[model samples]
Target: MKKHTFMLALTIVLSVVLGACSSNNSNNGAAIETNLTAKEMVDQMLSKVEQPSLMELDAATVEQLYHLNPELLEDYSIRMPMMNVKTNEIAVLKVKDVKDMTTVEDAIKARATDVQKQFETYLPDQYENAKNYKLIKKGNYFLFVIADPADQDKLVADFDTYFTEK
Candidate 1:
């Protein structure tokens, strides 16, 4: 009976310790520092991702991606986005300053809303994926993704991993 009680106590303590260790540090924490810029990180991430089905935007198209103040951005990438179809799209924007990231985040949100409405109107049956686009921000790094529903989580995780490792 003493051994059983001790074992249960040990298990409980282990569970608590493991749980605390695995908890998310997304809030109330500083952003991870990295040697590479956002553009380099995003480019490296694209090499890991398999998305031959989609088309990548050129520098000219990427230049026009900023609906807000384009001058604020240090660099940005917009990939695989077709105006009407439910195709894979991913973009990462690097702001010149931390404060500018919020503005860029807002612009991304507006773009998301616009894309959702457009896709909903044109492809009513498959608007769900576009509406559920993964949007994340870390420090001056802002990530916006709309990928194949089946591959969405893996793509987001891959990008997050790149940032995490930095």
Candidate 2:
């Protein structure tokens, strides 16, 4: 009886030791390292020719302008969260000095229209979906979102118009 008990205890200790050793070996067997930064990622993405155009718009009384002329948004569609899958780049427009606008919603509408027009001109091909515009207002800034590269050339061509008209 004594001998049998000793054997059982020895077997249990050996099994526990072997299990721990195997687990440790597996944990150390593989390792991976990556070197990436936010700026670097942006640069790399911009370097690609197929990337979409991004722009920022600066304007005064942006909110008032939209309220005065909402029709200017004839060529834009609201952007949705799921649209990220189809977009290769994003353009942000910052509007300045909108003292005339009474509300944030008006400013957003105006800014979105302006940005959408610019995007439409810059990337006519990419805007084929006819519903690729997003208008977002944060504090005093309005954000215009554009996705797709099919209209990149049109976007470039329309660049000059953005400055001349606005």
Candidate 3:
């Protein structure tokens, strides 16, 4: 009776150990990385939301508004409200080098601050939208969005799917 009881206990322990090892191995899935162009990346993120009618800006205008050096980025897509009353904007950028990520992120943050200040006094409702904007960084990509709060989480989740391990 004692020997049978000990065997059952040992079998249970071994099963638990094997289960943990298999689970750990399963956790090591390959990360979802991609070499998508700027336009494609922006399109993927925007697809997750009910896109508003924002006008795309030219590279020169984007550089002027965000105070970023175009040479530092591999590619970028920027859109904004044509009129000042609405505070809707989006920018998805890919840095040429990882070392320049800080500069690019800083420029995006500065742009966000500018957006906030612009709408804070002009339109309270839009100001709230600006305040709830998302600034997301994933590997060499960066995204800044001032959109409807309802679409914020969906946008973030969709962006993350590009980087999350499968």
TM-score of each predicted structure versus truth: 0.68, 0.26, 0.74
The 10-residue segment with the lowest total lDDT in model 2: 157-166
Question: Can you write out model 3's per-residue Cα lDDT over 93-157, one digit (the tens) per residue?
Answer: 88889789889989998888888898878889999999989988766778788888877777777
Per-residue lDDT over 1-166 for candidate 1, one digit per residue giving the tens place of the 0 to 100 score: 9999999999999999987854634533666656676566667767777664445566555546546775677777777644445546788777788667667888888877777776776776447777888887665677888766666787677767665433
49-110, model 2: which lDDT tens digit per residue?
34433332123232243443333321122222233223333332332333532344454555
Which portions of model 2 show Cα errors greater than 4 Å?
1-50, 53-91, 98-125, 128-130, 148-166
Please tell me which model should have the higher TM-score, number 1 or number 2.
1
Candidate 1 clashes: the total is 0
Specify the highest-lDDT model's number.
3
TM-score of 1: 0.68
Candidates sorted on TM-score, descending: 3, 1, 2
